[model samples]
Every structure is written in C-alpha cells, then in structure tokens.
Target: MDWGSTPHSSTMYIWHLEGLKKMDLRLRAFLAPLLFCLGFIPLWGIDIQALVQEQVKSAGLADQLVSVTNQMLEGAIDTGKNYQQVKQLDKLYQETKNLKAILNPNKGASKPTGLGAVFKKAIEPPVDLDKALNLTNALQKEVKNANQDGLDYSKILSVLNQLENSLQTALDLKSQWLDTRKAN
Candidate 1:
C-alpha cells in the first residue's frame, strides 16, 4: 500500500507535494499585504483622532466652546441676541462634528451605502469645505451689536476664531489624505 514501493507512484506523489508547496507560497504572498493593511486600519484611526484633538486644542476650541456657551446661558442677555447665539452655536458645533466625521469615518458614524446613499448624495450635495470658514463670517457685525450683561460678542468671535483654525487644520489633513489615496 506504500507508494514508495513503486518508482512510478513515488514519482507521482513527489510531483503532487511540489504542486502543493507552490500553491502555499502563492497564497502567502497574496495574504501578506492584505493582512498588513487590515491590521493598519485601527492604528490609523487612533493616530488620526489624536491628531485632530491636538489640532482642536491648539486652535483653542477644546474648552472655550463649552465655557462660552455656558456663560452665555447663565448670564442675562437680550432675548433676540440670546436666540441668535443659540442658533449660531448650534450650527458651529454641528459643522465641527461633521468635519470630524469626514476625517475617520470608520470610527464614529456609519454612512449609508448602495442606491439609497447615492440618492441622498444627489439631493444633499457634497460637503462644502468653505462652509466651516463661513460659519462666523457675520461675527464682526454681531460684535457691533453687543451690549454689556448680554452675550459676550467679542468672546464669541474669539472662540469662533479658534473654531476656524481647527477647521482649517482638518481641511489640510483631508487634503493630504486625498493626495495619498490618489497616489496609491
């Protein structure tokens, strides 16, 4: 029953083993790069998140956004201005969040896929990079309308400046990411 007993069968068995060895080598060659990229995704997320946080803190929005919003809420302010501040702050926060979502999409939110996603994109329009910069374009006018004991329009402007810087950093990172993808 041993193939080695016959020269013809032994030769056939040797060829079969050689074929398997070649196939194993090819599979390893293909999987090495795939596995490396798979392992890289989580590391990329952490690094990108850290970079964003660092940029946000450096731009000065990390704490000021919250503190300014709190002070405006507690202090007495004109009703109309109060409402305006609320609206503007909400928009700023939402825009900031959306930018972050764009950066490392795999980490935070899951986007829709397939035909539904295409339809949504068609209706909503693509993300406007200029939108973040324009968020506080009217702050100078708001500052002129400020009064004491009301919303600190000057401080609001300052915090928004930080928001602008943070957004700019995000935009820059996104550009780099796009370039890398294109090159790859």
Candidate 2:
C-alpha cells in the first residue's frame, strides 16, 4: 500500500488535529474566568517569609524553655528538690508566658505587640493551630499544678516535652508552607 494513496489516513489526521484545537479552546475558556477571579482574590498574599521568621522565633523561645526546664529538673535531682523545683517552675512559667505572648499576641491585649506582631497579624494560621493551642494550655496547667503541689516532676517534664513538640511541629509546618509558596 502506497502511503500517499491512503486518503482515509489523511482525513483521520485532519480530524485529530481539529479535535485537539477544539479541546484547547474549551480549556482556555474554562480557565480564563478562574484565573481572573484568582487574580482578584488574595489568599496567601501575605509575606510568608515574615511568617516563617516569626515561627522560627517562636520555636527558638520554646527551645529555650525546654533547656531551662531540663536544667531545673537536674537541679531538683542534685540539690534541694522543693526549692529548686519552685525556682525552675517560676522560670518555666515566665518562659511559657513569653511563648504564649509570641504565639497569640492579640490575646488579652488591646492590640498586637511584639517584634513580629505586625507580620503575625497578616500571617495565616499554621496547620497545627488547634493542636498548638491545646498543647500550650496543657503546658500552662501542668506548670500550675507543679507550682501548687511541688510534686511529680516527671509529669511536668512530660507536659513541657509535649508543648515543645507542638511548637516545633507548627514551626516545621509553617516553614514547609513558606517553602512551597516560594517555589510557586
């Protein structure tokens, strides 16, 4: 069979090209308004770099809290247990308070306050917002319990570990989100 003599093949090829052209037109038509609406809407329009930086700062503060708590635990083990525990509990309280202030600057305050408060205002919530909040609250309660009874150092340490984990998780999620957004 001679290739040029096949009229049916030429017709089929023309039909395929026509079909592709139609599909291309339909896709463009569907995407035009969607792209336009996306342009008008601001979803992740905030400066993600700033948000990531804030999360990093929060994570650093949480790390400090963890370090101090570990020191306190060592002190309790080596020195006067009750006195050392009380002092460490106070320090933990202050560090956790600062962490909370960083996490939720608007809480119990007239307005945002901190180095990254303005950026925090615009930043979207991390994937683990609820988890972070609950863990932070649990940490506070554990600190309160430790302060009141001066018992169960193990329990306090466990709660501090959980809080630090949550903070680190949030920081990781936020950083990943920022990296993805930047790549796009």
Candidate 3:
C-alpha cells in the first residue's frame, strides 16, 4: 500500500506502528539515559580558563586563581581537621566542583551527578565551586558584552542573581579562612 497517499490519520498510525516496531530494547535503554540528561540542561555554558584569565587579567595568571582557590580549599580542609569537620570541607569541595560544572558546562565534566557520587560528600546536589569562579568570570564578560551591545540591564541582573548564592558561599569560605588565619 502507498502509505504516503493514505489518509492523514492512517498515515500517522502506520508510521507510529512502524516506528515502535523499529525501536528495539537496546535503543530504549540508550534513549532512557539520553532523555534523562537532556532534561537537566543548564542556562549557559562557560569556559573556565577564559573566565579566570578575564577576571584576573594577566598573561599566564589564570593558574594563580587555581592556586588561590586550592590554597583556600586546603585551608578549609585544615579547618575541618581542627574541628573534626572534615566532612564539611569535603562537602564544600564537591559543591564547588559542581558549581564549576554549572558555570562551564562545556568544559565541565559531563558526568552527571547521578551515579557519579564517588567523592568526598556523596549526598548533595551537584554544585561546582570551579563554576563559582567561572560565574564571576562569565559576568565580567557579560558586562563587557552588554556595554558593547547595549543589552538591557535586566539580563545582567538575572545573571547576578543566579550567582548570588554561590558568591555568598565563596565569601563565607574566604571569611572563615581569614578568621582562621587570624586565630593562628
């Protein structure tokens, strides 16, 4: 039968049936994870190295941010050791990593938080700390782009809001680090 010349409803029914028959169990298994990932798309992707470079603005200085972040992270780890809160530091580190994933979804590890919880803290929403730094870097770019493009301020404000919580968390970590140093 010439399915193309059939009535619209009949055509759709035939196609649907054919499509279902063609779909194998293996295909369904593959599509299950694919659809699950597609459902969790983030708003924007960022480049971590570019962002660090932009924010710090120096030749070959992006590593400094990594060093600083690592130092601060280590300090947090030490604090955890002192307070028997190593769990907290581990949690913070994982969260920071998750934040980085959010900020730089492109370069960020594609491993979904699900079934990938083999880390310091295995029971929290995927938060990327690297992304926090990237967010700041991304905003710097956005501001420059906005100035060049004359985009509305509302978009900038929205980006700022998205990072507000992460920024606060970063600030809190800095403060704690500072206070710990002072105490030492």
For each candidate, the alpha-carbon lDDT, in order, equals 0.58, 0.62, 0.47
TM-score of 1: 0.47
Candidate 2: residue 163 lDDT (0-100): 58
Highest lDDT among the candidates is held by which one?
2
1-184 per-residue lDDT for model 3 (tens digits): 7756867868698889888877876698989999888775431122333334333332122233334334544765654444333343344345444444454444433456555645523643533444555655554454444332212334334444445544545445545545644743
| Model 1 misplaced stretches (Cα beyond 4 Å) | 1-8, 25-74, 77-127, 148-155, 181-184
Model 2 RMSD to the real structure?
Answer: 13.8
Ranking by lDDT: 2, 1, 3
lDDT (10s digit) by residue, model 2, range 1-184:
7646897878878888999999999999999999999985565544455455655655555555656666666656575567756675666656665665556555564555785677766773543455555666666665666554535556546655665665555666666666866744
The positional error of residue 55 in candidate 1, measured at the CA in angstroms, is 11
Overall local distance difference test of candidate 2: 0.62
TM-score of 2: 0.39
